[model samples]
Structures are given as structure tokens and as C-alpha cells.
Target: MLKEFTIQTPSEGFVTITKQVAQIVEQCHGEKRLCHVFVPHTTAGVTINENADPDVVKDMLLALNHMVPDLAYQHGEGNSPAHVKASLVGSSVSVPIVNGTLYLGTWQGIYFCEFDGPRQRKFCVNIL
Candidate 1:
């Protein structure tokens, strides 16, 4: 099954979407399944990471900003850093679903990564 979800993001930040994905996964009727989440924007992506503490998200964004600092770039859009960040984060993530539950670590969760935003975004989740 495939579903689309719309979300609003800050100019740059991570939005946790674990519960949303789990809600969909909960509907699946099998014990063995896989959930694929994808963001279809060049400047956005998806990932799974520590979710127990909010600081982890902050630290990640900070590290990314430091690692891909803005500088002179040939990209006309001037979002070269966003593009690079998105590439580093990737556009999709897959989570194993077992016994109708997301098989993530206790502190792991799904997140929508917005490198350049303060706008609406869409992500799709496919369960199989």
C-alpha cells in the first residue's frame, strides 16, 4: 500500500514522523513487511535516527550545516548547500515491520529532513 502525506517544515530542520508511519504500518495485516518512506524534493530527504532526545536532531542539523557550509557555488538557485545536504541525507529510508510494528531501535525514529524549506512538503510511504 502506498500513501501520501503533506507536512510543513521550518526553513531547515528535522520533523519526526514516526507515529504517522506507524499508524499506517499498524494497518498492515502481515507479520513480515517493509515500509519505504520517500521525499520527492531535491532539497529534502528522509532518515532514521535517534529520537529519544530532541538535542540529537539539533546536533545533526548543526553538524550538517558545519559540514556543508554555504559558499560560492555555480548553482543558479543558490541552494547548493541544501542540495548537498539532501544528497548526504538521501531521499528515502526503509524500516522493517515485524508483527505489525516498526522494527526500530528504542531511540530510533523516522524523520523528514528539510535542508531548505519553510514551505509545504510531501512524502510517500509504501508498505509491502
Candidate 2:
């Protein structure tokens, strides 16, 4: 089964959507499968990271900006740097589903990467 979700990011930051995925798992109703989450946009991505601390997200953004500064990009598009960063990070994540639950670390959460702006984005979850 595959599902697509719409997310509205208020700003350029990490937005955790673990709960949404969990709900999707619940709706699967005892099916054991592998879950793949994918983001189709070049300026966006997905990851599993520490959810307990807000500072981690801040540090990540700061570090990425330091590594790939917007001014340094030559693609000319305002979001060219964002596309590069997303490529480095990636656009998909896979998780094991057992007993209808996602297997994740205690501190780990699924996040949608929004590097460009406050816009609507789509996250896809596929179970197989």
C-alpha cells in the first residue's frame, strides 16, 4: 500500500512526522512489511534523527549552511543550495514494520526537510 501526505512547513526547519507514519502503520492492521518513505522534490528530503532536542536540528541547519552556503551555489536559482544539500542528505528512508509498529530508536524520529521556504510538500509512504 502507498500513501501520500501533504505537509505545510511554516519555515525552513525540520518537521517531525513520525506520528503520522505511525498512524499509517496502525491503519495497515497487523500487516508486517517494510516501509519506505520518499520525498520527490530536489529541495527536500527525509531523515531519522534525534527528536528529543531542538538544538540538534538547529546545529544541523547551521552546519549544512556552513558547508553549502547559499551564496556559494552557482545554479542561479534561489534554492539551488537547498537542492544540493538535499542530494547530500537524501530523499528517502526505509523502516522495518513489525507487529504493525515502526522499529525506531527511542530518540529517533522521522523528519521532513524543507530547505527553501514555507510551502506545501508531499511525503510518500509505501508498504511492501
TM-score of each prediction: 0.98, 0.93
Q: Which residue pairs in model 1 clash with each other? A: none
| lDDT scores of the candidates, listed in order | 0.94, 0.88
Residue 122 lDDT in candidate 2? 97
Top-lDDT structure, candidate number: 1
In model 2, the runs with Cα more than 4 Å from the true position are none
Per-residue lDDT for 59-112 in model 2, tens only?
998888898875755677778888888998799999999888998989999999
> How much is the lDDT of residue 52 in candidate 2?
97
lDDT of model 1, residue 21: 94
The per-residue C-alpha lDDT of model 1 at residue 59 equals 98
lDDT of 1 by residue, 15-118 (tens): 99999999999988769999999999999999999999999999999999999987999999889999999999999999998998999999899999999889
